[model samples]
Target: MQVLTINGQRRELDVDPDMPLLWAIRDVLELTGTKFGCGQALCGACTVMVDGMPARSCQTSVGDAAGKPIVTIEGVDGKVAQAVQAAWIKLDVPQCGYCQSGQIISAVGLLSQNRKPNDDEIDAAMSGNLCRCATYHRIRGAIHEAARMLEA
Candidate 1:
């Protein structure tokens, strides 16, 4: 058994230490917001915030995630998160919406560190996240809007 601080709550999970954090979050914890895409950590669909930094849950082991603060789409809060969500809504950034949660989490992670990110930075930060609907343009727009909202 390992204790994980998830969404500001302590969760005790009895699973293999080598189990991917994504499974622990989705299968064990039933927090399905973190998706499973490509499963090799190449796709950003399984992104989650571990200790306030975006991490690929599919590649992260539960043991490595132990004792760290894990935040999923359900647990995202605060000014940055709120701004990102608001901007996402305002810009209509989702097409199929399957990957939006991971996209949102990645956006929040980027915005948390750099409030104002240029297009290059946004692209670099979001490069790992792949949207099947090809909503990259809107995603970029939303991130910029989120930064603007943060400025306000």
Candidate 2:
């Protein structure tokens, strides 16, 4: 059994100790917003926040995540993800939209630390997320727009 603080709620999950935190979130908790892109962490599809820092959940152990505060896309709200979501909607950033959750989470992580990021910074921060739609430019644009909205 593991006790996790998720979306500001304490959730106790009776799961395998070795199961990936992504599985625990998706299987046990039924929080499907956090996706599984590549199990090896090569893709950032399973991104989530561990104590406000973006983490690749596919590579994270459930036991290791036990007792840690976790936040998923479904948990996202308020001023934190609002601007990003708004920017995303306003910019029509998603094509296929499969990678948007991870991209958004990564953007949130980047924006949390650096409000103003250059193209290189955006590239560096959003490097891991693989979008088959090839919407990198739009994603970058949404990040910038989100930053501007947050600043306003």
The prediction achieving the highest TM-score against the true structure is 1
Clashes of 1: 0
- Backbone clashes for every candidate come to 0, 0
Across residues 71-148, which tens digit of lDDT does each residue of candidate 1 receive?
Answer: 999999999999999999999889789898899999999999999999999999999999999989999999999999
TM-score of each: 0.98, 0.96
Q: What is candidate 1's local distance difference test score?
A: 0.94
As a whole number from 0 to 100, the lDDT of residue 60 in candidate 2 is: 90
Candidate 1: residue 150 lDDT (0-100)? 95
Candidate 1 — which residues are off by over 4 angstroms?
none
lDDT of 2 by residue, 77-133 (tens): 768589999999999999888888889999999998999999999999999999999
RMSD (Cα, Å) for all candidates, in order, is 0.6, 0.9
Q: Where is model 1 poorest over a 10-residue stretch in terms of lDDT?
A: 92-101
Please tell me which predicted candidate would have the highest lDDT against the true structure: 1
What would the C-alpha RMSD of candidate 1 be, to one decimal place? Answer: 0.6
